[model samples]
Target: MILSCIKRVSCGRIRPVLTRFLRASTAKHHDLESYLQFLQTQANVATESTYYKGLLYEYTVQHALKKLIGISPLTRCGGTGDNGIDLMGSWNIQKAKKKLDSLTILVQCKASKTKTGARLFREMEGVHSYHVSKSRQEGRTLLIVAAPSAITKQGFAQFQTTDVPILYCQINRVQPIYDTKQDTFRIDNFEHYSVVQGLLANHAAQALLEKCDLSTAKINVLMKGNSVEHKKASPPVVQKITLT
Candidate 1:
């Protein structure tokens, strides 16, 4: 069955031989090439599938962020050896708690089918640690993990004591996150509102401030029901030196 699916050739004849050969359990290496090919093809398909899911969610998350924070498009960086970092962008504001323009927005999006748990963030944690270590030597950076699926209560608790923010936002349209009818991205969690609000303040100008205010207010209205007790997250070190 596997070989028939992988090859466009007729397996009607080889199917019987493959079945009989399998039942016999004979050690015939000459005919193993087809099986090896099947294995490699399956492996490749699986790899591509996983990468595609990650990339799709990364892009959707970046789009949602722009609509949420009134920022330009962010870079999608999810791929092999990406250090679990998915989206990278810059957040500009008049003034931030750490005296930076939200230097760089580093996002890791987990598109898991199951409820997001602490285990899902293991790789991203390493990425965050690397940045936190070098933050003092560089501008401020806001590292965020966005799990579109429901994050179990335990998942939220895991990051409560850490500096990284766990955003319970969806990355695709099927998540039923908010107004799934349209391609709109609304943040449904309020735990980190202050952190996000500070980024969206945009006090640099009256027009930008109002725009951000409106966006944030809209989000607040949409997420009020899901809002929970707030937690003051540790100050993130970030600056708007430049983001490529």
Candidate 2:
């Protein structure tokens, strides 16, 4: 009947919204120190710069990437650049594939206190459309989303549907970061989408390989889904494990 059809149509639209709300609400979002709070206490810095917080978080995440995933020589391209890619680096795909291979990685970091929405993902899609996803002659390209606060359930769903392999790095802190310098409060925690966890299962099993997940961004991945948690290494403990 027409009534039943109307109900179905409405349900279809409402379900996703409801789901996103419920899931995002379930995620444990801690009280984070805002940029205003950080700038007010600081002596001299561009308080008008809205990107200050975002850029600071980028630097912090970049350092974490270096230690965890070995993203060396990372290029910082933030601010007015239309490209959604904030940081660029080389990622090793050896573990994902048999032979050794590297891909150019584009990273976009979203450190908003609340869950990131689909708008960010849309921008990422614009940066590298299906064309890049298909592996170009110049070289393969991989997109990495670095969200310290984590992405919303609805936004994550969009990522899941993408054919392109996206390395979703959920980098966060238990306490509010007050320091202006990226060095002060070291980020020790990270979370992953289910698909990322599955792809890095073997590596996760190995205490040595598990902690660093950013280096495996590759194509033809099944995108099979776990939440892989990682902690930063201590000063002395870090000297032992050799990166491959």
Candidate 3:
């Protein structure tokens, strides 16, 4: 029966030995490349894990680009009370002998750890355009949305939903690394969240700086959730700072 399908596919010729050999290898998971290629060609299978993995891959690529640009990536910057600006920083692009002035950015970190859609980007747009009114009037502004773990196809679609001029940052590949010597946990995908947040905030800061004819600027960090230490000897991870 299967042979008939192959015969029709291959112009009415059946190489029994070859057919048996291919099936045997496929059944044992030894032909992953072939299986994947088949899936690509057929376009019918929609596995959840495969979908998530693709999302992660796309986000990781964006994170890598932000890192190369010299943006001081951050995790979460804007607290619930603060406006939409979450993370802010600049890319110190090098020019002629001396380091060029940093290009400010504002980032919105999305750490939902699940698939996010256009509504998230649309919400950021609202915050950037109206709620956070300071950035827009200045002209040098950008709103960035970074999702490290998952970015659904719908979320990408949402990006076209607005003309708010926001940069999209998607981070995939979340791996936890424990450093016993340092007694600290560093997330490999931290840039994913921070870059998006930083780019958006940078836009606001840059505009303010340009208007003031200033070469440097800083951003305030706010958060809705409690700090890991919960206000003990150590301060909350979030704090205010002036960037130059």
Clash number by candidate, in order? 5, 3, 25
lDDT of 1 by residue, 11-82 (tens): 112111111111111132111222222333343534346654554455456555664454343655444445
Q: Which candidate is the best by lDDT?
A: 2
**Against the true structure, what is every candidate's RMSD?**
19.1, 16.3, 21.9
> Candidate 3 regions off by >4 Å?
1-66, 73-76, 95-102, 131-138, 173-175, 181-244
TM-score of candidate 3 on Cα atoms, chains taken together: 0.41
Tens digit per residue, CA lDDT, model 3, 188-234: 43342232222222333344444434322212121212123334323
Q: Rank the candidates by lDDT, best first.
A: 2, 1, 3
Q: lDDT of model 2 at residue 142?
A: 53
A best-first ranking of the candidates according to their TM-score comes to 2, 1, 3
Q: How many steric clashes does model 2 contain?
A: 3
Residues 54-73, candidate 2, lDDT per residue (tens digit)?
A: 65566655655554555555
Query: Model 1, residue 100: displacement in angstroms?
Result: 3.2
